[model samples]
Target: MTDHPLRYDINLSILFTELPLLERPAAAAAAGFTAVEFWWPFDAAVPDGSDVDRFAAAVEDAGVQLVGLNFYAGDMPGGDRGLVSWPARSAEFRANIGVALALGARLGCRAFNALYGNRVDDATPEQQDELAAENLALAAKAAAEQGAVVLLEPVSGAPRYPLRTAADVVAVMDGVERDAGADNLRLLFDLYHLTVNGDDIPAAIDAYASRTGHVQIADAPGRHEPGTGNIDIDGHLAALADAGYSGWVGLEYKPSGSSTDSLDWLPRARRSSS
Candidate 1:
């Protein structure tokens, strides 16, 4: 509702994964998003460069930007299924980072969200942090070369991830920066998770806005579009803008009903006026 400078990105996952992956970006652009993020275009069996190139072309033809990419999930082939639980999976995780970096480079995206897989029962909290930090450090180094940033999002209630608190997220970034000599690494602040996990959203952003590179939002109850449930959507947007965040805010929520039914929120003017 406030006059914020930040813009939002539509993810194909929320809009058109039900359609063929190739048509997802085009559908998103037609829905009025100027920018779109994707989970993994690499999953498509198109030729080496063709997969990303076609997707990038679709984004451009549809008059949108590819702003964010989600590249790291633990299930990457031959890679460890859980980074937090299996510290030794760093090698495969590095390969996953490489794939994401290449995709970012090809798609002209500035950020990639790499998820630290589920927690391992064999590791201590301290050990998980150390392993995550080490793995992230390696990722940051690779991302830096592509002129992109890698962000770690804390899954507070999901103990499978190492970053559960703002402090924990920041600590991981700090560790990567210190160990890899790259301060460009950052945290991806998901407001839904933050609020659900009992974090003071606005206050946390004010404190660590500089370290936060991207944001995602969803209503608390159903993880649906803003205003669908009881999350202060307007207030959250204002807080993010006030904190000097100038990047794309991801609408990483499920549409409660039909995906297109949520188009009423697309026009920024309407969203702000609401």
Candidate 2:
């Protein structure tokens, strides 16, 4: 595939599973990635400071720039999408803001993916949305202080996830951006999820690429590498570049086999954000 006008970063959270968390950065670097991103490194929103320090040191030693991170999303394996809207987890989410920002700041990460919480049995859609807006406002403000942007993404395979379309996410962003008072809040623009949810990728890019803070790729039919499915990954990325999206394209897909082996499709020459 020809190179698109974009930077590339590996999502260590998904790509280097065989290794322990602390080891993933070096593994990515060995695989030719100079930049990486992750979901929360710890299962809990707040881990011991020592654990945090060790993770930071690991990335530092590996010499990979941490580009993007997610705010604490509770029990991802159990299907919880995020904590930004759940009333019960509001305190946890708020508490996580400081920890997330501090880590991102130290790593010089400019993008923070804030997964909107799922629909809870106890809260109505309106109530949950209201809470999400408030919480996102808080995150956006804090992220701005560190010169980073808080990203809201529409996720698929998440039945309870409220943001399933680009429109769904932008509806909320309209309010958050107005409140943020700067460009600190933006859409994540995951191509696979939007395609899975039936949004026209080209139209979505035409509408939202200018507002997108970050981008992720995974082919549809299966969330694997670009050529493993029917999605025209390269064309879409080229369109995004044409539409004014100039940011990291995070490789957030699940591998069909060994993570390193899954990367045979990506040339080492195109791995960095040069």
Candidate 3:
């Protein structure tokens, strides 16, 4: 067994993109990961029921646990990171919660990430923040019913998108809890984003571990697999373990070559633990 205490899960959305979405889980399983996570699988917030069934079947067939998932961010690759804060898109976000919850229930996923929407030309920052707080509060309640927690991630590389620091996300989480009267909302401590935004990683872990609901990692400067970039993956992970974060560390990196080629950082022994 590896010395590290954090369990690892592959992020099928960023890695394994060479294959079809439904085919990626089995591909991850074949590559030795026993748990996986993904962004919303459908282009639209509320996809057809048949689409959901097929996706569900794929995960069940792959035999991997779905440990984490994102609430529908508008167009991930096309520059729309999320819509939870957008006034015009709030309906689309609300429509996605039931679908996300059902899939989470099916996969026994307890972590649901809610990306804060970018600032819109038509809406003031206060308007978006208010909308986001209200929508996320609703999401927290829905996720709570499923015994899950809602996550807020501070993204880098998107300037208009607010919440780029650990403090920013936790503040939002606290506001969400206060507004909803539910404690199911927490921060998603993504190391890659934290590093990109220039936050001290170990300091972030020390400050936010208890309030963090989920964690994702990719090395800095390239968003590639661990050890390929400058981050001290081992040291930071040890810090997380020391801080009592016995949760899944999502491998949310882009593979330099084939997705399987990125397994060098993950030990063979630890890859198959569900």
- lDDT string for model 1 (208-234, tens) is 888888988888877888778888877
Which 10 consecutive positions of candidate 2 have the poorest summed lDDT?
175-184
Q: Report the lDDT tens digits of candidate 3 across residue range 75-127.
A: 88889989899988999999999999998999899999988889999999998
- The whole-model lDDT of each prediction reads 0.71, 0.90, 0.89
Clashing pairs for model 1 are: 119-160
- Candidate 2 colliding pairs: none
Write the candidate numbers in order of decreasing lDDT.
2, 3, 1
Higher-scoring candidate on lDDT, 2 or 3: 2
Q: Which candidate comes out best when scored by lDDT?
A: 2
- Separately for all candidates shown, the number of backbone clashes (residues 3 or more apart, or on different chains) is 1, 0, 0
TM-scores across all candidates? Answer: 0.86, 0.97, 0.97
